[model samples]
Target: MNPSDAYLAHMDAIVREKVRSIESARAPEQEHYLGQAELWQRVADHVERYRDELSFIVRDLHANPELAFEETRSAEVLATTLERQGFVVKRGAHSLPTALRAEWQSVDFDPRRHRTIAVLAEYDALPGIGHACGHNIIAAAGVGGFLGAAGIGSGKIVFLGTPAEEGHTGKEYMIRAGMLDDIDAAVMVHPFNYDLSAHTWIGRRTLKVVFKGIAAHASMQPYMGRNALDAANLVYQGIGLLRQQMPPSDRIHAVIDEGGHRASIIPERAEMSIYVRSLYVDTLMDLSTRIDDILTGAALMAGVEVERSWDTHPMSLPVRNNTTLADRWAQTQAARGREVLPFGVLPDSQAASTDFGNVSQLVPGIHPTIKVAPPGVALHTKEFADYAATDAAVTAAIDAAVGLGQVIVDTLCDDHLMNKARSEFENAGGPIRATDLR
Candidate 1:
């Protein structure tokens, strides 16, 4: 059988079994959970039903891996599709070039939207490896989650198309704009090689520093040249020594983009890209600020003027995984027999930073990595890129959509569950966004 045919065959069994479970159970949480489970089975069936059409979406993303905040085509396509699906869509909600929100109203101007939920989709691709992180799948899964709850009886569903997760941390901008102003809770699942939870993400910042010196003939008047390259070298060495005193969790990495034009000349300018990270944003900034001291001191010693230009991505607070939400989410997912992980094995445990951390700081959120590839395979590789369209990944995507949708729906339906989540959120001692961290 062809790959598509084989995939559909396997998918059919998974969905059938899931539907059977749904038919057996009879509670709202169960019926709702099962009903939602059955919904995902339909999504899997829908994928098979629209394989060709959806493949176009994935292929388009693979073909053009745009940077964060610069995803013109991808955002437009996602927005247009959601609009057609009966959502009231807003483009550039946060004034971010690539940020948009698609809303579906059920109660009509809900004063108590009282409960609002967000299903997030990340669309930015790696600089060189297009969709290497499986964002195409992420985008589609976001759509699936939104579709799963397209017309729920109560509350509102917000499908957020966030651009620049790779670097822009677009979600932070959205949060700042009150894009999630009234949102009660948020949940997002990432494509991973395994199913796990209780992940941690470090805070991150971006730096661009430039050095300037008098240009002159290298051999003819070498004595007159200040040697910007040498000065930059000194700065790096200073940065390297500083690392020894920093906490082991801190990461300070920089690269020289230019040295001298040639041995025959003293380069007038040189630039470098710097990335600094730590488990906490406070530590990240403290570490990054130290690097500046080295740069300035080195330039003074070398008699070459130094110019520092830094563009830090949002200061991401450490990920605060909601223990209560996670425990309940796990139990609900486990009831389906898929074996949700035993917490603390997040995919990309080594990943330095993420905007999800920022969101968790603002409001309660889950950034769990769901199983999408073979256990041994690594992410950000060509092999994982191919798996983005795999049968296993697709099923997991549908399951995640249903699972997350149920979590939100469950939270919204229960006054107690909602309050419990909030109580736990405030207790975590995270960012409140107003006065806590300025």
Candidate 2:
């Protein structure tokens, strides 16, 4: 047998065994807080009634995909849908043209005393594979959750349409613009291969290194030339060597953005773009320092000057999952006939980064993953994008909406749960700015 075929056969057996392990694994049990059962029923009823409209929204977004910071049509459709549902809509919110804010409050609602919760929506698509990340599901489900919970007669429900989640940290921009100043808690759901109430999302920062050197004729004065490409090559090798000493959770990847124009002429400048990720803020910072030192050393060895910049876009901090909120989410999902797994059940190697992580560090939040595809379907692929528009995804969206709406109701009605969530947030070092760590 061919080597590639043998490797594939071996991996297939390993994966099958892992799948069996996950299937037999049991999630820890937790007591559910006694929230308003009647109100939750009302929320479910509203979701059931609005099922067709929600499906239309999800399909529409999937058909007309938009990229980050350029989701004008997506935002317009979402805003119009919310407006038709009796929400007070605000377009161009948080200094972003594509961002939106829609709110619904009861007649006697008092923002001063009553808790306020925000349901977030992401509609940005990937560059080539549109909706491969299933953000359309997020948008539709969030809108459904807000509308479903609108019938409650206490607290506030705000549906925020956040764009640019694929590459740019749109939530960070919104946070800096005071979009979340008065919000008590945040909730959002992402489409994935499994039902998970709490999963790990690591922190990520971007680095750009530009090497400046002198150009000279290759045949005439090659010795006088300092090749910037040499520096890039050296740094690339240094990062590979540094990987063995780094933690298993820490990741660094780079690409040569600009190497040279022609082979005959010595390159005057070269640029590299790199991404650094870690499981915690402190570890991320430490990794950043080590990467900087490596880049500087590469420039010194190449006898070239180097300029390094961090975070061309906003950095994404690791998500701090509020157990109190996540448990409520798991309970609600259970009622939907889904067994939502807690953290550590799934391999941490399956983790990815998200802008929602930035929001979680600022407020008590839960970013759970709802099942939209089969167990082995990977994200950011055309197969996943196709599944994102199927009936299975629609069903998951409705179930997720109902679950998120119930969680909001619980947060607003059950003071004990909210207090416990707040305590957990504080204990996790409460509202640390992502910029401060850098």
Colliding pairs, model 1: 27-31, 28-32, 68-164, 197-344
Residue pairs in collision within model 2: none
Q: For each candidate, what TM-score against the reference?
A: 0.79, 0.92
lDDT of 1 by residue, 395-423 (tens): 66666666666666666565666677789
lDDT of 1: 0.69
lDDT of 2 by residue, 177-275 (tens): 888898999999999999988887888999889999999887889999999999999999999998887766568999999998988878889999999
Model 1, total clashes: 4
Cα lDDT listed for each candidate: 0.69, 0.87
Question: Best candidate, lDDT-wise?
Answer: 2
Name the weakest run of 10 consecutive residues (lDDT summed) in model 2: 1-10
Error of 2 at 344 (Å): 0.9
Ten-residue stretch with the least lDDT total in model 1? 1-10
